[model samples]
Target: MRKWVFLCLLFLPFLSLAAEREIRIGLIDTFDQDFYLETFVPTIEHIQKTLKDYKITVIELQQHNLLANVVKERPDFLVSSAGNFVTLISKLGAQQIATVSRNHAYSPKEAVSSVFIVRNDRKDLQKITDLKGRVLSATEPHDFDGMLVGMGEIAARGFDPDTFFSKTLFSHYQYPDVATYVKVGAADVGILGTCQYEKLLTTGQIQPGEFRVLEAKNNTEACIRSTERYPDTVFYALDTAPIDEVKAVSLSLLSMPKGEFDFEWVPASGFLKVYDLMKSLKLGPYEHLRETTVKDFILSHQKELLLAALLLCAILVHVVRVNWLVNRRTEELKFALAVQRATERKARENRQKLDLLEKSRVISQMSSIFAHEVKQPITNLIYYASALSLLLQQLGVKDDRVEYALKQMNSQAKRTSDIVEHVRSYAKHKANRSEVFNLVEVIRRAINSINKEEIEGVQTTANLPQEAIAVGDSFEIELAVLNVLKNALKAAKNSLNPQTSVSVTAQKHMWKITITDNGPKISEEIFSALGRPTSTSKKDGLGVGLSIVLSIIENNGGHLTFRRIEPNGIAVDLFVKKKEE
Candidate 1:
């Protein structure tokens, strides 16, 4: 009887020490009531079963109220998703110790991904790069695990999540709203969490295969994640919490059973994954988030913090001033280098112009000599051919030879005319002169100058407007027109024997004049040569006519083109931009 009484007295204090102290677990209401009833209850039951030694009570509250109650209830532990965990830890001085990885028939983690959901029919969305500059719908920007991790994956591939997306919206009130925004096409791409997408599919809010992932980045860890797997729901230690208790909880989470739906607890680095992501993606705290209003700055920084910030700003200004001087000197050097480059460019251009002028002068002098020398011979040939034609007519020759002789005489006269025209074109002056003149009237005059005899064997037509006008040297324009007309006549004479025609058409548009011609087809090789200073015809050619034409046209801000007229002919087009009107 004495031994039993002594044992009972010794165990009395121990029994009082074992009496249950309250251990409240705060759960953020990230899910709706249905999910809380179905998923949360079972999960809480398991937690309670595992922590049987303490009087554990799980209190579910909305994220808005989680912080308030943390001060009121002072929970011994907190449980939330990776995103809510960040806010709770930051605001309530609570910590996250474990994260649940769900793997079930409803969601196969092995095939899970952060889906960049777009319309299945959009071919432009073949790659992630195509999503740049497109509007996106997502969760809140602060929801690191939900939107930011996926956004970081996009940024890693060279797209600026903030800028590449033309607009960003947080339409999801919580996890369930993602499917509605995507299904309605409110955005080009809707970013959603893996489990959230499953939930959406299960609820019939979204259809499978209706959306295709634009750019999928896979993460290992049994889930075919579309984004890098962030260290989820990291556990943080309260400043006042016993370090031993925190360590004990962390060890328990790590030592949990290895299974597909297992939860893992690792040491809480307080959203280090998010911090790293922000740094890599150049977003959030890692980026310089500009405070647009003074109120915004004040709300972000308290009075003491603001004072520290002001001192920091002063130091930053000093550093910035020093950097500014360095940059200014560097820019001055750059400007000097740019000026030197400009001088070199000007020198090169001037040299090229001088060389072109020298060549033009040499060609001009040679052409004058050739024209003067050839004029007498051409005149003699014309006279002799005319004399022969008259003799053949007087003989009344029925022979084919007589007819052939007359034909030869006509050809010789045409050759003489061509040479005279070339000489005249080259001899025309090309001086810088600006004057407003009717472009239509100038073209009509040039077409009229096309001799009737040249068009005798072929039909010729002209189409031109009556009121089109331009500002430039009229003399140069006239010379260029004549050269083009002469070339057209020559081309028409080649393939078609007496029935071929050349058509001249002019069109006017705002600040433009277009003259098109139809003649015998010319190859690109020959056409390219036509405007070259040294280019020429195959027979009896000096090559200066078209050269002079190009020179004059270019000086007046015009371009010349000789292209094939489809199957069998050529068209010479002259496009001039009117200087004034």
Candidate 2:
């Protein structure tokens, strides 16, 4: 007894909870409200019998008051036709819990369909198309079985359901009214839901031979239908419904015996067919789409709009990327140009130094030539003066004017001789082969001379090989190398990142000294007349430095040549007779 009491206590709260649970179910009042209780009371009683402790409330939903009542009454579940269920599911977040199958006559999904009815004697209605332009009796277009099914068939045949019939009597689309109207000749043709004809015959309200189904379609149903079948009615829940209680209600409805009622609950079937029907007719959930608006336009042209947006984004990205690349390249080009200008400036400075060197060399050459020539002439004059003085003394023909003239001539000749000697001493270098020195050391001297000017920003590189002995005057070699280096540096300075390079490579019979520069290419005229006095790049140049350098090198058993460097530069090669070890 104590154990029994404990068990009861444990179960007591659940029973009380069940008793306190109040459920409200909304029913779409598509049927006549007068017969609403008779039509739905059995189903409600079946539910009440299952949940004996729970209180269930019923709410009738008129078509005009569907959304408003659903919001105000807040029903836990909804029972309605498939079309009304679709509307509620879309607008109120309702989900199908079970489908209604009438008397186990058809599957839940393919339960109801429409049929065309005509009198037996109406031979004129041999086919559905024959009824075109004839009178049609049906409910509103929204009625799934009464009208939409048959209209859907007409539409499937590519006929406009609205215009296929010349005239139509529209109403609530009650099946019996359609049948009676057809029988009485009030309507030439009629539309009915699946199995309504059999029902009418069972009630003896119509004779079998009195009517004939037009174009009956063979399907897996107990009733003859002229159109494809769609799901019948559905039981669904709103967002506010308790899932556990809703499931209990579903189980109860499914378990309801196929008693006196025309319908029973079954497992939920696919409602997509109904949605398709609505789409074909442009009714129900698709009704708003008939109006023209931006939202509707977007919904209709969703793919096109999405593709256009993507293409636009791609173009924007491509443009942005291209612009960024162009900016980067422009900046790079600017930097490169600035560097080039700077290098060219430095080159000009070096060329100025070379020009100065050329001027000094030419002036020294002229002075040496003048001194050599005048030295002999002045000595001859002095000798002549001495001879005249001696002859006058011997002949005893002495005069004060002649003596003064001789003295002046002698003094002037001596003074001129001294000036010539000074110039000759300054211009000449007495280099002999006995002074055997390293050719590399001679190049070092030439570089040292160039460094005296402290030239900046000109890169000079020299490759010195092992003991490149050359049989020549070191001084002349040094001078020649120095001249070549100056020329290279001058040319190289005209470029960005100026480079002047000297390389010495020794052979068995000769040693090669090559100097290269990265500068403007040598002109053909300048190259052809190289090592000769010709037109030079300098405004005041007589091309004397390189000429003197060539002369000196030839005098020392060596020769030099100038050639162009590929791309933009010049190179000089000096082949000196090597003093072999």
Candidate 3:
């Protein structure tokens, strides 16, 4: 009974601790439990003191069992480096609450870096390139600052450390082992965490002159580092953690006093730099991701890729050449078109000038002809009037001869007026006054205009329709008929036993008039030029009558044609449209 009571009393404290509500935090055993205990125990004690209802427990986890431990234990919170937290946060639903900020010797921000070191007496390992075929040592393959950052720095300098160095020595947890390896000549170069390098210096384990940092970057914090910096550590909560407890622990950590741990909790910084390093080296959480080796892929498809490249180059060259040719041809065509337009414009201007000159010449010639034609009639009128005055004085206005002379004077005066009117009508280039009228009446009117003396020797016969109506300029058509009749009369007078006939016929939508004369057949050359101005067969002809008649017929949309009659006569056909279709 006494031994049982003693064992029960001894187990009381442990049982009480287990019974209390506790918040568990998981940490990776990066160094050792003692190191973490020394580093974080005070912060845990501070949190426990603040939260009286909850106790704090720290669980150290190995790397290989970290994901399993987190899933099985489901700790309330976790403590890890930024690189490890990145992997856990992605895979295990961990949320970062705060990042551990330290007053690092090499960085003013909460960051860590890697330093590459070589023995001072080794002159051959002066630069990173000198490490080719040399032995390299580091803490661990996945150590963010010790190995990954160091290799990333070498890669940034265009060197692949994996193939550049002959061998790589992994020291696992002891970063100091990397330094020792270099000092013992096991490695030509060493990569170590900047923190560890500084710690070794402070403890006098390695003198300042024994090893030198390679590619040391100068910073205001005066840290001896060769690689870019990354965030130091992070505190996060798992997805299954109690929300209230996570908040309380985060608040306590943020407000904790600066203790022996020398760490301050601040808002979490971006961990993308660590993520980028992992992705570059394919380490840690990124180890399972596959990557293509560019050298191998290029070598395997060299012929196909080369052919594709050559075809692409050829196509590009052809496109460029075709574009140049098209532009050149377009410019040439534009120039030719411009020249053609200019030439056409010049020809139009020349034609207008020629038309104006022709009009002026026609006006001058018609004026001269008009004056000559009227002069003879005026002189005859004056002579007859003088003769009438003498007879009236001698016979006291009673003689028939005096009356006859007065009539002759009146006739001569009328002839002069008609000549002047005819010349005036030709001078004015007026549009025809059109109306509906009978075609037979128009022909009779045209025949009445001809002088009886001119056709006295020719026998004239008219074959007409009683009611042939047409739509046109009646006066213009009358003049055209008169011109045709006068030509036929002249031709008939020249023939033996001269005879002339006028015939009219109506057909679909048109009136056809034929005037025939037993006259000489016209020569083809003269017939071709029959309607041209200044072309005539008669010696004293003004040569404009047929042309004027042709113009009148054309303006009324009618046609005039002359053909030789059978054996020895001429036939003139005039066609005009009926008013009603």
Candidate 4:
């Protein structure tokens, strides 16, 4: 009895492992099999612990054998680049579940970048164009960032690396090999990922400044990059995989504890950018297949070819006859059109002259009437205000209210005269003189022109670059700025705490000035009416301020747009072309 019990105990451990459910995962041979094993063992162990019944088995697949293995074995899941994921989804119906977020020194979790390097001592190799006729070393052709993206960068600069280089060598298994080749003078240039280069430096395999990063980019993330960034590796589930098991494994991977692996699985990031790269290179999902040629078509379908040729000849004859008939009809129509056009032109000229004379006569009469009618009202108001002021002085009127009323009367009379003068100037179509000037100076002058009382208690801020020079009528631009400022002030006054800010950004070809206000939201109806002539939402508004502003902006080759801000407010963007140096 004791011997039998010992035998049962000895076999129990093997029994447990044999009963454990197996979940196979396919991984691209980006790194060697040992590296993947070392990196993913912790993740697999974690998944097994979380779901005790299931154990993960990682299967390394070469690029050439990747699709074949997936089709033959049908692994439950996969780990590969975004480009490969797109290809698999299209070719094998695989679905992406998660993306690997590599925690490298210079790479972001969602994307990676490639760097082109040459020996630092090689001053002749200054740019991508300089790589022409030089020996180039790269990883496998299908390597996304390491090989393909670098080729795209060179191709964009009008150099085909394959033909341009005197010799091209590929390191099939490891990217580091390319760097080593370039370092030892075996190759003039090499391509590798930024992370891999940094790793080589940290490990003392490559010295600092041993290789120069060619065509270095000024990336905001401080990453050493040469080519445009692309999305990181993807973790996907096959269509044949069990949904429940896939979900369990996906959740486990996403929530897995972070340790020495330096990477974690996050939800899938978009792969359209990768898809675009694939299409541009004619690889992966966009791979160019063998197209049928004329010879092949004829050999395969002799009877169909004969029938097609006869039908084509018949169609050509029909087309030629139709074209000849069309030409004959077209000539007849042209003659009729010419005669009709001549008659219409004579009639239109006579009508236009008559209309112009009538308009001139009407305008002269209206101008005379307006001048006569408006002069009498102004003269009477001025006379009455002067008399009232004299009477108040002579009578020794001690009442402050009486004196104030006289003062207001005089002010109104002067305002009436200014309006009349302004109308006359507008009717005369006054020309605007344009000159190049700094926009910041114009904004300051406009702000100073506003009544201090109108902007009282409003917190205002301006963000302007040192120089935003533009060519336009300074007076007109200032007037537009004043009108926008006035509207923003009114909006600010309506809110609990009034705050307005102006931000200026200089773009490649234009300057963008944005004014934001914190106030009650403008209704859609009122917003839609803005920018139209004689449109306003204010109760006592003349509805001409924004109209004039719009006209001024449009006449000066600028654009203005209004947007409603969330939680209450408005933003106005003013775009103007920068002055050419």
Candidate 5:
């Protein structure tokens, strides 16, 4: 009985806390301070000291997920890291009331930055490109402000961090790891937080003279030290958040105690700049969501408008005069038919042009692959011919043996020549044509033609059925599938090692075949671009591969879609209707 009573007494504080009106404050996990004592507990302590009416709870989230969770939580207020706050204000309509300057390195005008560092002894490392194919070390992959921006600076200097870097080594342990990774030669280049590196050098944890900073211009934003300064945290409520609560919370944060923590509240920043950044960088989820929402709205309204117009025409036709109405109806029907035909014809022509453009884009992307593929066969031909010439120059060479050797060498050269021609022909044929052929067989032939021996950088596996057939231009389907396969292959190859493989699985159901890939995912921007001619990646692609694929599928009464895989990668589902039994 005594034990039960004690347990009930212990639960009283939790019950009272739960009963109070909840005010959520979002925090980022990047803040190294202990939340139990620093932000959350202190804030709650302040609330108890100041506001007697409400109960406030602090929720810590990563920088990337913080804004999204805030939108979901519909938080009354948010108190997050300075850098993350800037990101929110720039992208979302979040406002800032107070900025908490960490006493360690916080100042009125200085901000922290992750600087690029490399070993001083390494040769051939003057420019950014010198770090190509070298191991890059970062504290965390998703440390956007710390690592991403620093890398972006490198990319701005003409080296694409994603493709140019050979290996990425992530050490989430902080400055010590960054210094150690560089000192021990584990990483070719290391990114370190501004003060962290200085602290390490001061503490004798790392030798300052052992590392060199890449010569680049630097700037400051808010208090953050950045190569290219981005604004510090701003607090504001989003569209769905309650304004009164936000204002109240903002006021509360501004009135916070100075003894425990030194921070000030400021007005919320505009997202137009952030939107512009997103457009410029093509990073983040906002622009893609906006685009998807707009497209969906347009499509839905178009369908409704068409249906309503058709209904109005049918209902109003009975009120007009008989002969006059007949002539008017005839003209109207002709006009409608003509419009329909014109729309379809334009769509078809646009699709054809898109196809040709995609083929060229794919060819351009695979130039290195082509060069790599051609090198071996050409090298073999040269080596063998040189050996044959040397053999002929030897004394007492039999005529019959010489003839046989010549015949063999000629056959090998012709085979190599044929491989080159096949690759060239596939890339060169851009015109659209409609001729029925076995789609399954065409896929097999494409697989066979993949130059598996010469270009071993990509691994491709296709699970196509033996007897599946569809009546469409075989060449077009081959090209479309080839492009997708190549894309998947490249994505895998780029992100991972050269041994990465792309799996293509074809699922045949009642009148449909779905081709899927287990490769790096297609983002929303690329997925939403299906059948649209204007979408493209910056790799000089005309955004025509899927457009042409969609066109071909539509022509054959089929559909193409990009489905998101749960764990990773993307499934480029090409739904083609089966021929009649």
Candidate 6:
């Protein structure tokens, strides 16, 4: 037993050593090893600092033959363009650790893009399809953003990118060279990447509006791109890479600051957009989708297709049954709707008849009230007229009595006329037409209409603004205010020290007429029945005042409310819509 335990302990060190993964990073060759290394020096230094114990080695691989070398070497980390990363991910289950950010561009997830350019003088090529049979000048064909991305855009628009252009011209990785070719009329259209045209304009090699963009994407304001953006260069982790080591590298890259490259390292974004583009152009991971045979697809999807066929049959049966049920229900609902509409029509006619009967009752009641009320005024006017006639017969005896008699007769005549007009309007139950009237003036008229002796003998105060414009029927508002003031005066008459105050205030969207008095607290029954017809606290009350006030105010987008004052008082708030300043 001791011997076996010793052997097991001795192999533990070897097992730990075998578990450790190699920290090797593969960098796709861009310009040269030195240039690429310098560009990503900050990232390299950061990784070295983070994984101090591990020996990190970066290998530069040629872009054209990276796939073979990548599979053979099985690199733990691969820093390459999004297209290469996507290919590696598809082939070897590679996962991107971080995306490279760029200066003066969209986020790292949506930075790489390509554009189609033409000289401003090329009026013949107004659109992208115009360059279909024309010569296309572009940078290196192997370059992802400069050439391949533009080709993907063409494919996405349903064009065969392989045969879209009659002839192709290469500018050999110089983005500006393609623009130069277009400017010199060597090619009908040129393709560029990474705002090369805008850079040239900044260098004064191209003027504003000197080149036109074809099928330009408004995806960004930083550059004019013809194609949708994919993610920026990514730091990727292979399937064989150790999870702990990959996490360390990711942390180091993300924490690194922008150095000479003027770009930052950020967490990798989803590459579904890149995958979709590659699928459309038959590139990268989706290359096999284009190569699959029809027979292979049928064999692989036979079960799904069979299930789909069964589902379709079941769906057809369900649809037929549902259609029959819906038709029958629709007919039954139609009959019910017809019966309901007929019932509604009968109810509406009955309502009209009720309204007519109510109006007739109002007319008869108002006629009787008018006749009873106008008799006193008419009798007084006759007496005053007889007195005036007597005074006129006695000539030269000019006294104040003659003038008094004439004024009394005129006053009683006016009263009689007002009563007649009011009863007619009340019996008809016709609403007054609304208009913009000064509320200050309406309140003044209401206060003046009361008996002068009663108002002066009591402690009544009127505080109103100089101008308060309201929107409502002026006559209705005046009547409402007058009736309320009359009630307040009557209630305060018997008080030891009667106090009544009428004030008009202008609110944001409403004109408020507040009538308050030191009278008895309103009864709950009277308060509840407020604004309702045939409800009154006074023995001789007609109950028309508050109802008319509420109805008119409500109809004109206003409100009426009553609040009980502390101790022993009642406050009335009449709100009407104030004209906007």
For this target, which candidate reaches the highest lDDT against the unseen true structure?
A: 2
Best TM-score among the predictions, by candidate number: 4
For residue 55, model 4's alpha carbon misses the true position, in angstroms, by 3.1
Stretches of candidate 5 above 4 Å error? 1-20, 33-48, 62-74, 81-93, 101-110, 127-129, 174-176, 216-226, 234-241, 260-263, 268-281, 285-581
**Where is model 4 more than 4 Å wrong at Cα?**
1-20, 32-38, 105-110, 158-164, 173-176, 220-222, 289-581
The local distance difference test score of each candidate is: 0.62, 0.79, 0.78, 0.76, 0.60, 0.78
- Give me the overall lDDT of model 2: 0.79
TM-score of each: 0.39, 0.45, 0.45, 0.46, 0.40, 0.45
How much does candidate 3 score in TM-score?
Answer: 0.45
Residue 116, candidate 1: alpha-carbon lDDT: 72
For candidate 4, the TM-score is 0.46
- For model 2, how does the per-residue alpha-carbon lDDT over 1-581 read when each residue is reduced to its tens digit? 99999999999999888765988988876643322564477888889899876799988877775688779888899888788888777788888888867664557788778889999889889888888899888866556667777888887888877689888876564554777788878788988776777877989988879888888876656778888878877788887888887878888887988766567777766688888877777677877757768888999999999999999999999999999999999999999999999999999978966976787687788979999888898999999999999999999998999999999999878867865765575488543354567888888878876774534678888889767767777766776788788878877888988998999987668888999999887678667778865556788666667877786777777788887886689889998887766
* Residue 412 error, candidate 1, Å: 78
Mind giving the per-residue lDDT tens digits that candidate 6 earns over 477-510?
8878888888788778767788899998877899
Candidate 1 segments exceeding 4 Å error: 1-20, 31-40, 61-69, 83-96, 101-113, 139-142, 154-176, 195-208, 218-224, 235-237, 243-272, 279-581
What's the TM for model 5?
0.40
lDDT of 5 by residue, 109-155 (tens): 33445667788877667766677788888777655445755666665
lDDT of 1 by residue, 1-581 (tens): 99999999999897876653445666665543444555455555555666566566766655555456667766566665555554445455655565544443122112223667777767777877778888788875555555776778787887766677888878546643555566666787877765666666678877887777655554334333466555443334454555655665566555655433344333433356555566666543344553358777678779878799899999999999999999999999999999999999999979867876777788878767777888878778878877877787788756788668767777866656665655655565534566888777777777776788776666566555556667776756776877777766666677554223333344453233333334556666776666665545558776667777777777777777666654356565666556452
**Residue 409 lDDT in candidate 4:** 83
The TM-score measured for candidate 1 stands at 0.39
